[model samples]
Target: MIEGLEPWAQQGLGAATGLAIGLLVGLERGFKLRRQKEGKRVAGVRTFSLLGLGAGLAGVVAETQPIAAAVILLAMLGYLAIAYAPRLTSGGDATSPVAAAVTVVAAFLAGLGNVGLAGAAAAILVFILALKDEIHQFVDRLEERDIHAIARYGIIALAVLPFLPNEEMGPYGAWNPTKLWWVVIIVTGFSFAGYVANRLFGARHGTIATALIGGAYSSTAVTQSLAQRLGQTKGGGAEPAGIALASAVMYLRVIVLVAILANRILLPFVILLAPALIVAWVAGWWLYRQAEPSDAPAPPGNPIALVPALGFVVFIAIAAVAARWAQGQFGEQGIAILLFLMGSMDVDASIVTAGGLPPDLIGAELAAIAIGGTIIANMAVKIGVTLAYARRNGWSAALALLASTLVLAGSIAVAWLRL
Candidate 1:
């Protein structure tokens, strides 16, 4: 079908895409203004459709006469301004006129071979308009700290990251500033997303929701926090359930990170660990079923604090250098041992370093083992937290977590024996 189209026909198809977008947007606007008196509605389906067609025709004219396209755009803007001026003078709303202006611009871009962007923007605009109430509610809910958190994220991702040197530096070529910052970005982004989820749903959804969402940021931290909360309460089962679920989610998080950064090893990693993950999830769900419903407050503080980001940079740099040095000095065994130790403090850093290992130095199987060690060690930390803080209700949660860890350890053992 595409092959048969001539140049003019191809341009026509582009224009048609633009026209469709405009019509879709216009349909929504018309529906929105349907209750308004006819004269009070600033623009409607017919007006919008004509504007889109005019923009598209101008695009066609631009191929031969760019000046004509410019004139057309200016004329459309002037017409919209003139139409809206009288309405504003008479105390009418400005929303319809602003929307009309934006629609025309989107239509013009769509006709200029930017159909994808124009369509996406139009769809997004419509969605935003539709969600007016929800948007206002969300804004009302935001605290000053939340705005500061967003600003910090923008600085980290947009301002600072781009300026970092991409080349490898430090000992054993272990530290690349760009790569380290990217890891920071991934962690911060995950935490920020979890923070948003917690804000939006935590109070209404209770402990299970908090734990499940919070796991993406820091499962160990979630476990610790839940345990502390449980300590203060009279014995209810919510703490155990939250802890188990969060710990289970951590395994899934690991699986995802491995799949992204070490895909070649993901198959073996999943095969060995997935059964444990399933068992943990089922056990957690059962615990949740047993628990009395209880709300868990969102974790306090900004998710992407500068101190933590800097700390992560230091931690990862050290882990990477340690892993490289260990491999150089003691071969694969050294790297494996280091990974086990590192796992107790930060499994993520171990996983990142292991995934980044040069293939010639450490094979995929060995890297997977290193990752498995970190998983086991990280689970141990969570188990310790459960025991330390959730004193009254800790046993059940700790037992459930231990059961999952043992399954994972058994799988790793079997895989190691085969290797």
Candidate 2:
């Protein structure tokens, strides 16, 4: 936007933006300190506004005089340090002084025509300041494992993901290191988000809420967990309801992953899977209504399971290579067969593989059918797990899933007919 403006106009706009940034942060700070005595507060809206105005004008000058800009920044920093000296020596909170310095820097950036960055920084600063108490309370609730999980996620996402090569390699040139790792990151990130949400709300919201959240990452795992809980006791209807609800969430997760990684198949995939999704949810809600309230089941394990994530990347690579070979050997039909077989064990891997395939190798309709088969196969596995592990106690869940599976099969058949 600024690029089209004359230099004088751009400078005026930049100065105005800087003033707005300052006002935003200053308002928040002033509100927080409203109860304090006037002299006790180091800075307020007026002081901050002047500081921003001075910084913006300095930035305008800096376009031609770099040293002048540096001197202006240093002078502001020096003033802040001196103003905050008594607070520092008294061991009081130093956040205000630091915030003041940041405000000056953001205003300067704005004046330099980096309006986006400056605006974003100022907004974030105000948000952090406003949420001080809530943020601290949240920090207090975090456990050591939770902290470690965060760090692990950071390593994989921020540290490891960027550095990986993006070139295709391995058999049939199927594997791209960055793409595979990205799948891992997406899966793990979902799991982490679910885990954190479960920790925050599962206890108060009861079994159904837990099921919904848990399903975000691994519905199979959620199923097994709830099934085991049921097997141990007479179990309330909520347990079966939770199990069904988690399965419903599985459909939601799959549909989302398909949309993100393989949008070509999304329409057919959703059409084929929507019946099962609806059936599962309806059954779950019915069962939950009949059941008495029960304790929320224990949440899942670690958020970012690094070892499993690495293993998943390897599996995706194998599936991708195997899918390519299958396409070569028997054309599109062979690729469908490959996806169905691989998806029985890992639907996500199959989705990623299908997404990476050449556009001509298989049409979207056929790809969706192949993935639908995998979904059915995966549902069968979960049903078997429920039966084997939960035994008679799991009959309600098994039956609900059975109904969905039947509906899903019928949908696939109808889709096949349309083709």
Candidate 3:
């Protein structure tokens, strides 16, 4: 069987593959030309296939003399010029010869790629070429705002991030610009994530995702959203369940924040509250089931925007400085004070910042306690918000939601029984 396959067979196989790919890509290019509302052009399937074949042979010859390939490539360019000489008068920049040349090269490379990522590229190129109309249409539709977003991200990563000073600054003296920027990056990166999640997943996943993102943007906004939603719909089992769900997510949000900023304190809270939180959430889920299902309303919230990202970075920088000061002046007590105060305003920053900070350097445990206490404190605020909104909206559902949360809190305390 091996003897029947001659040496020429391998070369023939490559040629065959190259010709097939070239034919497909060439057809796609022809369609692209037709879409320009131009008459038929000379270059089509056969033309492209031959171009690939000739290029492939030239590449083989260049193995003996390196300069030979460049000579062939330049010669091919001349042939292309001759072919389009008459059309050149009308062909404006839209003709895009570079794109055509690249298509041919890609098809040729696909035949060569028997081992590494070779022929697959040709297939991908063919598909991409097929989408030329759609691609062009997409580009045409992108507004100035879209371009600005892309450019803004580029400037941040390429220009601003690279030049920032790494040195500590101010009273607490722990702040580093890069580190703070990275914190901003973490928080800001989630905006896109949350946006995509909310768009793709919708409210069927429950209002929890809404609450988390809302907490990031503004918990006050989330309260307003919930209140408005309550006003629109008749109070039902699912209504109170939604409120409890949002409030539960609040704890999760604070916990996530603390995990990033103050891990030492977060670790204990995780240890203490892990079971309680799990039980509370699980019970909430069960409570959710007990209420008859209504299509959950679309969550009312928005992701954090660019200004918020900058504001958060500045706040984190300030917190880092405050933490450094407390380390020296407040000793262990400084952490408790900082965490207790900051955990409520925005708990995650203080809590996450404390992680891995030494007990002697900073009180990690106290920081964790502060985060938990803040979450608990926030619960009370949510209840007040819910009640007030209920009164204004005339949806008694908030009362049930608040009652469910109280029950959940009790269950959490109970869940910690063995722990």
Q: Write candidate 2's Cα lDDT for 99-214 as tens digits.
A: 89889999998899888888899999998999999889779888899999999898888889878998988878888898888888887887788888887888678888889999
* Model 2 error, position 59 (Å): 2.7
Question: What is the Cα root-mean-square deviation between model 1 and the actual structure?
Answer: 2.4
Q: Show where candidate 3 strays beyond 4 Å.
A: 1-159, 200-220, 237-239, 249-266, 290-302, 355-359, 392-419
What ordering of candidates by lDDT runs from best to worst?
A: 2, 1, 3
Each model's C-alpha lDDT? 0.82, 0.87, 0.58
Residues 235-320, candidate 3: write the lDDT tens digits: 55354555555555555655676566555566666764565456446645654675655554554534444676677777776776
Pairs with steric clashes in candidate 1: none
Clashes of each: 0, 0, 14
By TM-score, the better pick of 2 and 3 is 2
The collision pairs in model 2 are: none
Q: Which of the predicted structures, 1 or 2, would earn the higher TM-score when compared with the native?
A: 2
User: Please, what are the lDDT tens digits per residue for candidate 1 over residues 1-419?
Assistant: 14677978868876786677668778988988899887876678888877877786776677788999999988988999998899889898787787778788878877776777877888987787677779898999999998889888888788888889999889988888998888888878877987887777775788888888888777888898888888777767587999999988888888888776667778878888888998899889989888998877566445878877889889889988988888879998788778777865777777777777787767677678778878888888889888899785688899999999999889888888887
Which candidate has the highest TM-score of all?
A: 2
